[model samples]
Target chain A: MNLWRLPRLRAGALAVWRRNILVWRKLFVPALLMNFGEPVLYLLGLGFGLGHFVGDMSGMPYLAFLASGIIASSAMTTASFEGMYSVFTRMVPQKTYEAILATPLEVDDILAGEMLWCATKSLFSGIAILAVATLLGVVAGWQALWVLPVVFLIGLCFAGPAMIMSSLASNYDFFNYYFVLVITPMFILCGVFYPISTLPAVAQGAVQLLPLTHAVMLTRSLVAGAELTQPVLHITVLAVYAAISYYIAVILVRRKLLV
Target chain B: MWFPPDWPGLSHSNFNRHAITFYNAGSMDTVENEVMAADAPTIRARGLCKQFADRKAVDGIDFDVYPGKCFGFVGPNGAGKTTTLRMAMGLTPLSGGTLTVFGQSIADHASAVRRRVGIVPQADNLDPDFSVEENLYIYASFFALPRAQVEARIDALLAFMSLGDRRRAKTTTLSGGMQRRLTIARALINAPELIVLDEPTTGLDPQARHVIWGRLNELKSRGKTLLLTTHYMEEAERLCDELIIMDHGRILAQGPPRELIERHVEPEVIEVRGEEGAALQELVASSGCRQERMDTSLYCYSRDAAPLIESLKGLHGLKFVHRPTGLEDVFLRLTGRELRDQ
Candidate 1:
């Protein structure tokens, strides 16, 4: 019930966090390229090739519209990759968590470190796309920088559920169901490619229930300098998703490893 | 050195873990030395038990590990040694009973207790992503050891494990012996007083096992407290100052290896085998020595080997060996020769 007390959040977790950064830095070029390159291709390829025919939607250029949407989705995708594959690999096959568990670190510290690392990776992705879009002139004034923090939130938000998947997974193949059933559907229906208002009324309401839609809405408004519609509602939804799933994720990891 | 440079699942939040308590003390090594001299147990378990969904993994076991000594648990594959060790580490929650380390119940103060302990798990869990030295540094960071001190300690540990030349080699690239040594070095990174090794040399060749045994002996000589589980009877006899032979989730016998040998087995053994062993069985029985029989061999035990050897002298086509009874005799006497897991 007390989610705040759930995470150990100790200096031990920082060691785990620092360890991840050290490894990431060692493989910086490939790690950065994988997270950054795909999104830019999505932004340029779909933004121009697809945007040319689509023209403007809701009085905005299609390329600009897609850029902000991609920012939020990038956070979701990158964090999901980390939370699912990396977390599972560390927890199971590599037995890295077992090694750390032998140290002063508790299970709470390991999972907290993992979620935070996932968030950090999410930021890396969102920021790269944000920078690219800013250079392309789609991004607005300094207000667009606010997406950095939101992207972080989205990263943490998405990482929680993705970690739950990782905890539940028995093998790497188990992640395919998550990507296919959960992530891909959200990517398509969450308005990254087009506005959700175009959907049928019943389908529009269904997409609103998904966390990615709220993420897309927040990033689009901030990056495109657009008017907000119930921004508090969007932020609240992301926060709730983050908090509940994070709590569940910690429990799941405990059951999977420590217990 | 608060933790001799050698050497659960309580909910983490209930007890505050003091990671840097020793560093605050000006003379940390002196305090550690004092603790080592004291008789207080670094690890104590009473009525400790663990029940899995389908099995009672550990059934009401009691044990103690003292500082500046090496202790051992020798058992078959399914004898619950690993489960008991895991419970001692607080990696698994106990089904019953109390376990205390550093005189504090692990159920309440695991982190505080764990800060002074190091472990080499049965499976190789080295982080393949990092090189040997980087892996050591990362493990050190978990204990929050000062970076400068850890840098110095890592060098010493690498040298101690004979890994000075391979500091930057990726862990995946290391041979099994080298990786096991690195795992041992990682365990010592925090300079823990209590080092728990689970099957430290299970898969190693004879040369590799000897290298490990030598390193373990050096750790013991350096006054680090060690608790380990091994299938190697010779390793147990050579290294363990005190040991427990366990089976079916219970300790069948516990004592110094030599004492266990003396208590349960004859001082001498004559192992006879060949096509002629059956013909020699009556001769062995006639000698009045206690004996056991396998498919084609007869193992005779006696307080003296004179009669057993005297009968075999001019015999042809009979292979025989005479040796002193060892821990293996006591172990097989108590636990039986049936395959535990199979």
Candidate 2:
């Protein structure tokens, strides 16, 4: 019942994380397609097809502009889907968490394991897109290696809040409302496809409040070799959102399942 | 409750606790547990309570479970049996009062406590993705057990549960009985001192139930403590050394199954079915014996059924059955014959 009380976590959380890795390895083929295929399509189909007529965006070629945006967008969806759909299946119908709870692991350990696994999948999507975009000769530098750690942070940034949504969901259909209402809208508005400056003043202000806005600003800055307006501020905001949402999500899930 | 045809001397008072055929004091896995059984209680609860929005599931009950004894919680469905077990395992937080395991508070030392204990939950929650042996390996990994040691234990446990042939089979492909046996094997993977099972054989066929019962008795004979809940009076009568009959989140009675039956019911009972006869009913009521009436059956209990039978001798179409009273008669008498949670 204590909102601020930190759950006593242990290193055993990694056991749960390892379990997921084994399952992912078992289903390697489809998982690889899902993680890598869609973003590649969006990049090549939209980047080359749409980049043909349109020339440059923000002093960069249209293909280069969309590449970093695709990394941020794809990372967001991959992490969010893991936190929502996969986590929901394990938590509810599969009853996996309940089995874990019977052992030495606490509910906190299970949630931490789920969050780490979600972030890992997100990191996979981000790295795959970045690799393809580099081979296309659209963007490359030693500076892009720094994008790996930042993309991992971006995965973590979206994971906690997406799990909060997962803790709220009752079934798979509930995630549609989340994607349509929250995720897809954030995808379009967070400067992923173009600059946020083109939007109306109030809409731009509202977009600034979204988590993906900060995520895209950080990864895109590192990917496109552009100077960020305030790098520390964006990173801090994402980290704070991740922390606060994570705390609230733990409490909410405890209420939902442990009652 | 099944007795083999060869063991005619096995009575309720001296079943298998002494001179067990399969298990003996010399063969106990750990001698430390045999000594620990003398002093400290394995589980203790005081003024325990669990409250929902408007009702309490476990309403302020006190009990103690000593080591080397099979204690039972017997109640109808929705009588808070599972809730109480969940609290002990630290899966659910107690709304009020104190519960301790192995002399440590469950709330404060849950992980340390759970590390030594094993749980067989009410439902089958085996991982569908893993093989039988893989399931055992994955579960053992939680305890951080050494791989080499666990590999040997898994092989022995598979054979113990008669799952050796199904080591590589998917959990989903096993029959219900095999799945139940696998779950029991999984629970014993760590060789825990205390095992808590909730309705272990609820949905199984009679043969599966008998198999699990035999395994549980073997564990008990080896001096592993057991705490279980069941609506089957026969299960409680056979497995538990002491049991409590619970209803509506409260215990109605607690003692050895034989002692509880004796305390709550007469030793012999006569049942009369068919025919509505005010004359026969009045004769039995005036004869000073206990009586319970259902739709068409009227049960009369006394030290002797001869007088009651002699009085109702000529009642037309009325059938009579005389037999020794058992734990089911006491359970029905204490809890009453009514559909709970309706």
Candidate 3:
């Protein structure tokens, strides 16, 4: 009758993470192709095509301006897809979660492992974009190395909410709405393509409220070698997302996996 | 690493606190001595209940599975067999009452309890992406087993399950029987003191079923405790030393297979199937042979079958089969012939 029991996180989650990695390794090439393909196309198409007209935005070429946003959004998309689509497949269609539950691993362990894998996959996509942008001479200095850990934190932020969605998913069809409504809007409105300043004053305020916007702000400032005015606030917002969503994900996934 | 000194179900065995050592702490001779020396059951359920919204999946069932023995939950589909097995493994939470594994309350220390127990679920949920050996390796990691130790055991387990030939094969490519065997091998990675198999051979062919049954018997002889659930009467009769027959989420009968069969069913059974089944039923009735009818067949049970067979032979156009009565009759008598679906 007690339905509000919180999950207990334990060391067993690493095993679940290890299992996903073992399986993911078998198809690394295809995964890498998917991870790198989209961001590269966006960087080339949008940065070059759009940069032709938008010459300089507050002091930098549009390409450099867009590179950091690409890194942040890549982390968001990779972690979101990994958490929503991949985790759903493993939980429902494959029944992999049930198999893991049969062992000593609890549901919290399973969720933690999933989030870790999502973050790992995010690192793959984010670092790939960072490498490509660095080759194009968009990265200002070694201070841009700080973006790696930030990307991972962004991954955790988006993966948490995505896992919450996955816990409620009954079938693959449920994800279409999530992608179209939630993820697509974040991709376009979170300063990924253009500065929030271009939008109306109220719309800029709204954009700042999105987690991706905060990630983009940190990634852009750090990658541009520009001094951040409110670095702690940006990091605090993303950290809050990561922490709160993780707790919610654990509770939701436990209800889904345990009966 | 602390085990409660007064663990409820272990009855003063001198095994180490770590459950992993419970299986390997002593030799076969020592295990046999302990099996005889130990008085407590490895698993015990007292009025355990599991309610899902409105339905009672496991309704206040009580039973004990002794050490170094095979215990079975036998019932037809949706008879709560799987639920009871899940409850025992702590996979499903008990809605009411007490259930313990390794003498420890599962709700209080599920991970510790699960550390000493292995489970083969009703469906084979093997990682389709991994090869047979890789599946075993990853599963071993959940128990925190050392790489060298699990690697050594993986070789023996693969051979024992007759899966050595397919060690490198993708789990998806394996046959149903092979997948089932691989699952069993994966469950053994921890060298668990108790193994719970939920319908271990539900869908296998006769040969595959017999092969699995043989391996399960071998495990038992080596002093491992086993808990399994199945609807197959023959499987229950062959594999279980003690069992409980369940239906509608309740235990309807409990005893050893042979004892329950003797108690419920007559020693003999004769089947009459033909256009003349009614006449055969009448003859069986007049001869005082207990009989039940289904569709176009009549089942007659009696203390002896010679008279029943003799009476059936004179009835033209009627075919009859005479055989010894077994657990199936007991199951039918207790759970009935009505279809059960959930």
Candidate 2 clash pair list? none
Model 3 chain A: worst 10 consecutive residues (lDDT sum): A1-10
Ranking by TM-score: 3, 1, 2
User: Candidate 2 chain A, which ten residues in sequence have the lowest lDDT sum?
Assistant: A1-10
Candidate 3, B24-65: lDDT as tens digits: 578867755454334456897899998998788888988877
Off by over 4 Å in 2: A1-4, B1-38, B274-288, B307-319
Task: List model 3 lDDT by residue over A1-259, tens digit each.
Answer: 1235565678888888888888888898998888778878988898889999998775788899899888998899889988988999999889998888888887778888888888888888888888889888889999998999999989989999998889899987888888999889989998878888888999989888899999998999888765666888888999899878888877777676677
Candidate 1 residue B7 Cα shift, in angstroms, is 21
- Error (Å) of candidate 3 at residue B192 is 0.8
Assess each prediction's global lDDT (C-alpha) against the native. Answer: 0.85, 0.83, 0.84
lDDT of 2 by residue, B1-342 (tens): 222212223432243343243344555644334433434568988888999887889998887776778889999887888989988987778999899899889987878888988899899899998899989998898888899999999999998899999999999999999999998898888889999998889899999999999999999999899999998999999999878788888888887898888889999998887756688878888878998987788889998878887877766666789899999999889888876773
Docking class of 1: medium
Candidate 2's docking class is medium
Using lDDT as the measure, what is the rank order of every candidate, best first?
1, 3, 2
| Count of residue pairs whose backbone atoms collide, per candidate | 5, 0, 0
Error of 3 at B102 (Å): 0.7
**Which parts of model 1 have CA positions greater than 4 angstroms off?**
A1-5, B1-38, B276-278
